[model samples]
Target: MEVLALLCIVSVAFTGLTRGAGLLPDGPLNAAVGEEVMFTTTLAPTEIPFISVAWTFGDKPIITSNVENLTEPEYEGRITFFTSTGYLQLRNLSFNDSGEYRVTIVPRGEQQKTGTTRLDIYAPVSNVVVASNTTDLAEFNSTVRLSCSSSGSSLSVLWLNGSSEVTESDRVQLTDGNFTLTILNVSRFDQGPFRCHVFNPVSNGTSDPVNLSISLSVSNVVVASNTTDLAEFNSTVRLSCSSSGSSLSVLWLNGSSEVTESDRVQLTDGNFTLTILNVSRFDQGPFRCHVFNPVSNGTSDPVNLSISYGPENINLTKSPSQEYFEEGTDISLICSAVSRPAALFYWFLNGDKLSDTGSELRLMNIQISHSGNYSCQAFNPRTLRDETSQPSVVSVLERISGSSVTPSTNLPIEGKSVNLSCEAAGSGSRMWMKDGSYLILADNIALYDNNRVLSFRPLTKTDSGEYSCNISNPVSSDGASYNMVVNYGPENVQIAGPSEIRVGETLTLTCSAESTPSARYNWTLDGAEIHNSSVFTKDNTGLSDSSNYTCHAMNNITGRTSSAVHELSVTAIPAQTSGCSAGCIAGIVVACVVVCAAAAAAGGGYYIYTRKKRAKSTGDEGQDNTAYSGSQELNYADLMSFQSKDGVTVQLGSQNNSSKDARDRVDNSRPATSSPPTYDVHMQRMRSAAQPDANGAQIYAQIRNS
Candidate 1:
């Protein structure tokens, strides 16, 4: 029943409907986005007399039943509707006009509909062009940002890098509602027309082409130290540079030649800074700073550094007294010099400079030929100057014979007690030996005095060597040889371990050794090497780091290696049992002391117990011995203390040997003077005094006063 009622209503509304004529479009139109186009449809009467037509769009009435006309905003002033043929014309067509148009007509109170058509508005087709910072000979691997714009909307962008067109990608972005385009990461090949096309359903548009220009030039260059002239082999200089605007590096060149790697010249930072730590006369030259860019070449003017220098003071001297000596005796001449510009030294004999191409002038094996006047001179090229010293005269001496040295039959085990004697064939009264380069005269070795037999006690290795003596004035000298040896201790050692050890954790180690004196050590992990460190440690087992490490006791002087290695290992109680933390550390100290005591008692019988036991056990004992050794180094401290015999204290060790024993050991034939011999000469000379002349100027004229 509902369906029948709906059908009746629809029929009543169409009851007066009749077919009518209306105008409509048959094709599409073209125009720019902002421009407008018109589309029109008209209504007309059909098969009716004395009747009028009404125009209506869709279901809305646009004109009265007796009238026929139509117009739209998109076609205002450009659209017209006619009733005769029912024709309509649209003047402007815009994007918004692209829709269907409908027209309705009515005659004699009867309605009719007939018009229906479609409209499409479009803009004309055109082309766009794109460009970059450069085109021909573009910079390689450059960061170039590109852009493109057109006169139309709804456009797409296309880029051509050289021969290849870049597809729209993440690196390229479109903005301004797709009217403008941008490209990033432009390379050398990215140089060409980029196209921008604007299009819609009707037409397409494009822009003209643009070219790019890129530059690759070097920048940021500098030099170190202002250019200046300096002395050859006496000055230093440096140069440096950096680059910007391009990744191309800069190189340092000396003239047209490239500088090679050398001790004096250095290059760093992509061939930027050229450093000359030191300069020499031969190193003086023109230097160039050059830059090389991928697109271009750059260079700086040449800078020159000049050098000049010269030599200064020269001096000559003779060793030994310049006094009289026998013919055929040996003599020495030494030449020394200082220079301002640093000069070469040359020796001259009798005013004639030696041309042997060597600095020294030596006269081998004394002969009459060696007796002459000699001088030396130093010359400098930089200063163009030379200097000469006063001449020196040399003389020779004759040889003398005698029993110069007496051998020491008994050698001291602890490096003490030695003897030396010289019997001169010419009856020389005194003797001396060369210590280092200087001569030391001694009357007696035990007591170094002016006039006494020579005997040396508590001798060191340095005491060994040749000795010469003279018996009387003008007597020939005699010579002999002797040898002394000594023994020393250890040095250079490192100790490492926990400041405090916990109980039962295991793994505690203490190691030490001798170095320079070439020594080995006994290790004590918790307490002692060769003994259990568990006495204080909670664990009985030794840590890998712990052991009796002996820098095997070595005496550099004796050059002897230790016979045994010291090893130590220990086990510790758990921290809970040992009061673990603080208690464990205390236990360690007690254990060390106990072990030390045990070592001391065992090494030497308790009856002979001395610090030697301490020295043998703890490394500190060696230090004590060293202190004592330094103090006890000399056997005789006071050489002139005959009155207070006890005044001379030998510190190396306790001196129990009496002076009487020293005297008894001495030869009875040798004069044993408790008071040492001395040479004291006093003489007086008388002379006349001169009186001044009337001028009172202290005249040089011959005058005398009584």
Candidate 2:
């Protein structure tokens, strides 16, 4: 009856019996249970307000007006009415709610209009499951039936083996709307994990997997061995077999015969492993393993064993084994031995092993140094043994000729370019050595022409050396030597001397310079040549020595000269001193010395005082100023201590330079010490001394005894 109602409703929707046109797509609309559905009307635009809107499901009203409680009791809270658009929606619908639905809209001044559609609700596919009629199945004997079941309405079912849909044929059949599958006379290929899919107009579902457990037989089998190589009496071996399927057992075989257990041979791991101890040469066999069950049997591939033995009776042979070979000849030597595994070989020259590792050694372009006792050694890694052959003697002969070194020029000057080339009569390699050591290349030095030439740009003094060129080949070797000289600078000339020295002390000065081919020295005073040696000395320095001295240096090869100057000042050492100032000295008369001589007769008092004596220079060519010497560094000399009657102690130091005579008192204002001392010798500032000769005049009275 429900189906008949849905059919009638669908016929009314598709036909032109519905009132509104262009409303919604014509339908018996399909919906699943527990889902929502909506209906909208096609009330044409009228520019008039809607006076009434109504919706109905079958004969019962779902929504009619805003003030009426006319909605179906089951749809009370599930219905929504849009009065302006004349649309209706229902939520959480059930299978019983499927029927004809209609919506009516009444404009203020027009006749009522209506839209009608059919809503068909279906239950969603759910809870799908698959089951097999029988669990135990066998190939060629058993049958299988797979059944699919689910809960839903208006559903269709399908059978699948893996991902492909299952179809009926001679051994297969699908019954009951494809909800059941059956296979007769099942083969091993018919073992399957099968699934079923069920679908309705609104939904679809798939069931979990089900499978037939058909009894299987053996198919693939393989054998593995412990070792392919076995020593004759020093090894053991194991072989194992493996196969697929159930209820399986293993068997061992050598060729075609069944293997039995013995003291030396045994089977373990359910006869899958065959072990042989103290393996012998006769034990080498092509072995096989067999796997079998009640319904099937299989054999593994054969495994062959190889027995290992010895390296012995070693011998070596030489090709072109002549006693003597010319230099640059080729030779080959081959070594052999009786070995189970082929032996590796090495060559020896005079008992020292060469780098060759194969059974053969080849020497190309041999040199005289290759002449020696030649031999070979053989080693077997399997047997762990070694054998050496008897030695064969070889000799090579050759000669070296015409080796020489030539320079770019006969004379090399410092700060100039030069190169040296080395060559021999034949083709060979050349190396350059200096002073018994390899020549080191520096920023100014370079090598070219396969190291046959050495060059120096802006050659320096360091480049001078005894150089040797060594040329050599397999034929022979020869070397040539040379002595090179570079002429360089007479520069940075320096003189070592004190700038001032006391008269009567030796005044010495020495000069030096940086030069190659040793420098010559010359000394000059005031631009006049005085000496031609590196050192100059004056045993008795006089005032004339107070002048600039020069030392000159010359490099003969480079022909350059340079000079440095030294200034030497000579000062005289003064005599002793007493407390009498020059003031006291000039005032006392020579008659006082006479009076002192007269006092010897009376012994009234000691002579008054002894004046401090001053050493004077009269006619020095480098004459300094006038009546008194300037504050020179020599003033501290000739100090004399004097004490007056009141115990007053004073140091009187001589301060004078003569104008062919004596002159002034001490110049107190001028500092007399060379260093910055706290105090100085000051004059008493008595009445000024008597002015003395600017022209050979004397100031002090010289007392004479006749």
lDDT of 1 at 71: 45
**Candidate 2 residue lDDT tens string, 1-706:** 6577456445544563443344444678888889987775544333345777777778888777744436768777998876656667888989888888876666665466577788899999999999888866656777888888999999899888888888899999999988888899887667667889999988999998876666656668898888989886689998888888765778888888888889989889888788999675456778888887655678888889998755567777777867667788898888888777887788899999988778888888988788898888887787776778888777776655788889998778898999998877756678889999998889999989998888999799888999999987655789998888888878899999899886556888999998887899999887899999999988857777899999999988888899999988887654533345444544343334443454444443321112233323334433332334342333322212233334444323333534312222333554544332112122222234442232111222222211
TM-score, cand. 1 vs. native: 0.24
Q: 1-706, model 1: which lDDT tens digit per residue?
A: 6576456535644452422222344434344544544444332323343255444444444344353343434334755555444455554445655545555433344455455554555554454444444443436444555555444444445444444655667656666555445556555444455555555655655556555544466665545555567764556676666556554667677767887668878887767777675465445567777787556667766677776633434677765547434554555566666655556777777888677433456555666456567888877765656678788876444445655555455332224465555554433346454543334534324434443345555554445555444444342455554443332334334444443432223433443444333454443334444432211222423334444443234454445444333344433422111112333333333333443454344442111101111111123322223322321211111111111122331121123544523422322243322321111200010012122223222111111110
Q: What is candidate 2's CA lDDT for residue 244? A: 84
Error of 2 at 592 (Å): 8.7
Model 2: worst 10 consecutive residues (lDDT sum): 695-704
Candidate 1 accuracy as lDDT: 0.47
Q: Residue 583 CA error for candidate 1 (Å)? A: 99
The ten-residue window of minimal lDDT in model 1 covers 678-687
Question: Cα RMSD to native, each candidate?
Answer: 41.1, 19.2
